[model samples]
Target: MHWISMIGIALAANLDNLGIGVSFGARSTRVPFISNLVIAILSMIAAYLSITLGMVISQYVPSNYANWGGGALIILIGIYAVISDYKSNSKIQNENGITSYIHSPNKADKDNNKVISWKESLTLGVALALNCVVGGFGAGVTGLSPIMTTLFIGLFSLLTVDIGVRAGQQIAKTLIGKWFNLLGGVLLICIGLYEMFV
Candidate 1:
């Protein structure tokens, strides 16, 4: 049960990192190990803090209400992700700096350096970590262990980014990269249901 939640949340949360990796690969940009590590650490820290917050909320609320509220929050996040991604597909919507970076990760590189340095990764990491904050809190309210979930998120973030970049053209050209947001949304919806019902 715990394993299911951990893995599901980890995979769902890191899909954006994978998409970022694909974008970088498409641009032939490299996220060096240190830079990737920096990103992963930020995500971990965000997840930890948000999860703690959710756990605190859970303490103040009835278990059933907590489950319903948290599950609804996760579902809403999933729906929002799906709708945002769909709109992104249908038209050229104007986005702010951080949002633009999320959709097109190449912008995060800034200096036109083929490599993402550790320093450059800080902002990018924060952008990525924001996605985890709410989701982590929702999962935390469902009683998933904060430490375990954070560890899983960090591991998956590291691995997904590396794998996406390494897979390069092959993955970029595939439907997976193109449909990443949808896949992530679907996964989150499932996890939300699990949290509420199981």
Candidate 2:
């Protein structure tokens, strides 16, 4: 059961990486191995920090309350992601660092270098990691292992980005492709519900 929850959280966290990877791929932008590694490392660290905070919160709150509360927060975030993507509100989304990058992955390739350097990757890493911070807390509250989840999140992030880039514009062009991250959102909802009941 913990394994299920662990896998679910990892998968949910990295789906956006795949979409962003596809965005990079579509524009011929490159996410070098080092840059990708940097992103993964940052994501892992962020997840760990948030999960620890959640564990702390879990300690102070009743198990049921913590479970329900964390699950509810994750569900709300998931729903927001789905609705925001569906609505495509430029004014608001444009101001969002990550959302804007999701729309134009090439922006990460500053200097028009086509390749994302490890140095340039810092911002990307932070932006991507922020997406999973809240969910990391939720999973931690539900008793997921911080180490395992962090490791899985990092592995999945690295793989998804690499594969998505390899799959390239083809993946981004598919009908369902546009909603890829939204699928992750749905998975978050399912994970939240699972944490609540099981």
Global lDDT scores for all candidate models: 0.88, 0.83
Q: Which residue pairs collide, candidate 1?
A: none
Prediction RMSDs, each to the true structure: 1.2, 1.9
Which candidate gets the maximum lDDT versus the true structure?
A: 1
Once fitted onto the true fold, the runs of candidate 2 whose alpha carbons sit more than 4 angstroms away are 89-93, 96-99
Cα-based RMSD of candidate 1: 1.2
TM-score each candidate: 0.95, 0.92
Please estimate how well model 1 matches the true structure, expressed as its whole-model Cα lDDT: 0.88
